[model samples]
Target: MPTPVIDIDSLTKVYPRQIGQPARRSLDDLRLRIGENEIFGFLGQNGAGKTTTIKILCSLLRPTKGAASVCGHDVRTRAARSCIGYLPENPYFYEYLTPRETIDFYGRLQGLDKATRAREWDALSERLDLRGIGAQRIRGFSKGMRQRLGFAVALVGDPPVLILDEPMSGLDPLGRRMIRELILSLRAAGKTIFFSSHVLGDVEQICDRVGILVEGRLRTQGRIDELLNRRNEQVELVVSGLSAETADALARDALHARRSEAGLHLTTADAAAANAMARAALSEGGQIVEFTPIRESLEAYFVKEQAS
Candidate 1:
């Protein structure tokens, strides 16, 4: 196993009771271990405590109970802070400052010298497509523009880990793609990434592992294929040389069946049923054309869990 870089153990956060309300727990014994250079996707519906967990990891909020650490250092310490580059759900900026000024400002805060800051700006501006708008004030920039600049700001310190909350919130398709690819490249460059997003499709595309948070608790966490394998997998068996009547007979127990120009298509709840149908078709002098498994998608799983 790779060395653990981000660790959370029995992490719990409870909101204090208000005048008219009882105490509410935002995170309950949430535990997760993310290894070095891993892209861990945090998934949850709205108000599921995803942000609360992220805030605790970023040291923006104290967990009512339990602990969280970055690179083996407590989140409350300077060492842990130094290991992370954070991008909040809504990235705020000095409206009067240009992208160039903003990038340099953050670099300075991270203790970079003039020469180093300039080099950092050059690389980030080019990568984030901020070069053209470098001199333009951010006050009038679009949401996507600010998001790109915010990501550039996060990289100002070249931290070893990135903790992003809704990093793709305001980006267009191209911008989202850019950010997604940038994240993958960052992991390739040895950065550990932990992010929470409602964009299940994007997470499904890039994340090595994912944790689903539902109502302040982690329902599950594991590799995409492994997690999905626990659920029933649908299989489609296609066969040729079978008449409509024969196809109907063979696929009588199938979830759905159809005979098209392509072939006789039999969709079953599991591979075993598909195999049975294929055997029946083959025994009837039919030629097996294909068997395809349609795995449960992250979005489907996420929706079901949230509703559950």
Candidate 2:
């Protein structure tokens, strides 16, 4: 197996009691291992401690207990931090600074000299499609433009890992497409990405593996195909020309079936039973419109996980 680029071993973060109330356990025994060059999706609804996890990983927030390591370096050590880059959901860049100037400012903080920052900024500007807007103040840039600029800033020193929080938030379709392409390109360049977003569709499309966080805990984590394969217990049966009485009988026989426009929609836990029901319908006066197994989708799996 490949070495993990990021590893969280029983990482826990707690907020001490404020005012007069009890302390808050923001993260309880969170554990995850993100492999090298993999796009790991961090999925969760609002108030699910997704941000807290990211902050702790980025070393912005100290963990109350446990440990997290990035790129084989402990997060507690200062040397481990230089290899990571973070892009917040809303990146606040100076309005007076141009894209080039914005990147240069960040680069200076990274200890890059003016000549090095200029050279690096020039290359990144072209790579990120910020050519024409190099001289324009960031205040006039659109949301997509700002996002791209923020990404360029994050890549100034070529960090091995990226921690992005809602990188696609507030982006239009074209902007989303651009970011998706950029993410794929980064993966190709051997950069491990740990991104959190509410956009499940984007995660499904790009991530090799996804970890679901609900109620401040990671409920599940695995390859997308593996998860879907594990939840493959759905069957659908379509029957037509059934009388109201026959439909009621069929519904009672099946586990969960409803009447659709084409015919009766039947969803059974047992595939063999679903097939038997279809055969019975065909043998009787009822017509079998269709009988196909319904594959579980990512969204359905999330809902089921939450329900359980």
Candidate 3:
């Protein structure tokens, strides 16, 4: 079997509080296995322990229970620290240092020789749009610029695995697109990427697999196809003359049926049953309009999961 780049088993973390209150638990029985060369999206609402999990995986925070290994090395072991790269949601840079200087400084910390650092800076500066800003102090750079620099720092070590937290949070539309392309490029280069994002659209576009977390518990994890298969079946329709009564009845069947300018839209767990209902609507003098089946999208799945 191909070795898992990340093997986390029954991981748990809890914070102790004062005498009168209960101990706050951040994670409980969290388990996951991420393969090499996979762009895995770690998904969750805010305060779902995504950051805690990343911290533990990077060995920055010791787990309160269980264990995890990254790239065949114990996370607690110092040697394993060199096998991974981390990009925080808010990347901090020395406002006084230029982009090139920032990269060179981190490159040296990663044990790169002066000559090697020079070569890396040349390549990364151009790739990351730092050619102009490379010599300018970071204090004046935009949020997008700062994020790119952070990514460059993460790449300095040439680690096998990457852990990024909300990497696209502060970026613009174009900057977001740039980061997405960069991630796809990294995946093509056979690098493992583990990232958390509230941007479900991007996650759906770039990830090979995804894990959904809610209330610090893993609600679901799998490939896109598999997750869709396991979710409530939905069919979308563009019906012409959907009567108000029929629409109300369809909406009451634990299905989402809405009237749009194009037509009526219906989403349900049972496609056949929904079709039967549509027939019933027709019998009741409801005009059967355009019946286009709308497949459930990743965003819909996310919304359902969150609501659940």
Candidate 4:
């Protein structure tokens, strides 16, 4: 097994009571590990301690108990912080600073001199598609632009590990794809990523392993490889022009069936069964409207974990 790039052992955090509000446990003995060069997706619902855990990892918030380390260094130490590039749930910047100035400012904070900072900006600007807006003030930029710049800032020192909280929140579809591809390319260049997102589909596409946080505690942790390989595959067949009687007959061979304006929605165990049903429906003057293979997905697994 590879050494863990980021490790949390029995990490817990609690908020002290406030005026008219009760103290709450934001993280409850959560334990997790992300291997080097791996994409680890942190999945959770709102108020699920995801942000709490992330804050602790970034050393922005202290844990009430337990410990977390980054690249073998204590999270509270400067060494650990140096190895990580952190982007918060909402990345905010001075409205007047252009992308060029913003990147330079963060680079300076990372201890980079002007010469080195300019070099890094050259590569990042082109890669993140920020060339056009490089001189534009951040004030008039849209959410997508801000998001891209936030990611660029996080890459300032080219840290080996990235900890992003909801990095894709305000991005449109194209913007999301750009970020996703950039993340993949980063991993290809040997950076380990630890990101928390409600976007399960993106997690399913890129993560090698995933850990789900529920109610401030990690409920499950496992690899995504072969996560759905053993589960049964269901194919949905929608047939139009089928009479009520024919639809009922088709349902006999389907695991389940329903009639809708689109047509009869029939689900079968596999593609073979679906094909057979489609043939039957066509023989009865019905046309095939849709044939879709439905597999066990990360969303389904996530839902199960939540219910459990």
Please provide TM-scores, in order, for all candidate models, with all chains considered together: 0.90, 0.81, 0.81, 0.85
- The per-residue C-alpha lDDT of model 2 at residue 93 equals 92
Positional deviation of 121 in candidate 2, in angstroms? Answer: 1.7
Off by over 4 Å in 2: 20-22, 230-293
Clashing residue pairs found in predicted model 2:
none
In model 4, which runs have C-alpha deviations exceeding 4 angstroms?
225-230, 237-251, 257-266, 270-291
Model 3: residues with Cα > 4 Å off, grouped in runs? 18-22, 230-292
- Tens digits of lDDT, candidate 1, 188-263: 9999999999888899999999999988999999999888784578998889998768877876888888878888
The collision pairs in model 4 are none
Writing each residue's lDDT as its tens digit, candidate 2 over 178-284 gives: 88888999999999999998777888889999999888789999998898884556688889987888788889988787776888998877688888887778777
Residue-level lDDT of model 4, residues 1-308, one tens digit each, is: 57799999999899999999999999999989899999999999999999899999999999999999999999999999999999887799999999999999999989999999999899889888899999999997888888889899999999999999998887788988888998999999999999999888999999999999999888888887566653457899999997878888899889998888898899999888999999999999999999998878899899988999
Model 2: ten consecutive residues of lowest lDDT: 227-236
Q: How high is the CA lDDT of each candidate model?
A: 0.90, 0.86, 0.85, 0.91
Give the alpha carbon lDDT tens digit for every residue of 87-181 in model 3. 98899988999999999998888888999999989888877878878788999778888999999888886788999999989788999999999
State candidate 4's TM-score. 0.85
lDDT of 2: 0.86
Cα-based lDDT at residue 221, candidate 1 = 93
The runs of at least 3 residues in candidate 1 whose Cα sits more than 4 Å from the true structure, single-residue gaps closed, are 19-22, 230-232, 239-241, 253-255, 259-263, 269-291
Arranged by lDDT, best first? 4, 1, 2, 3
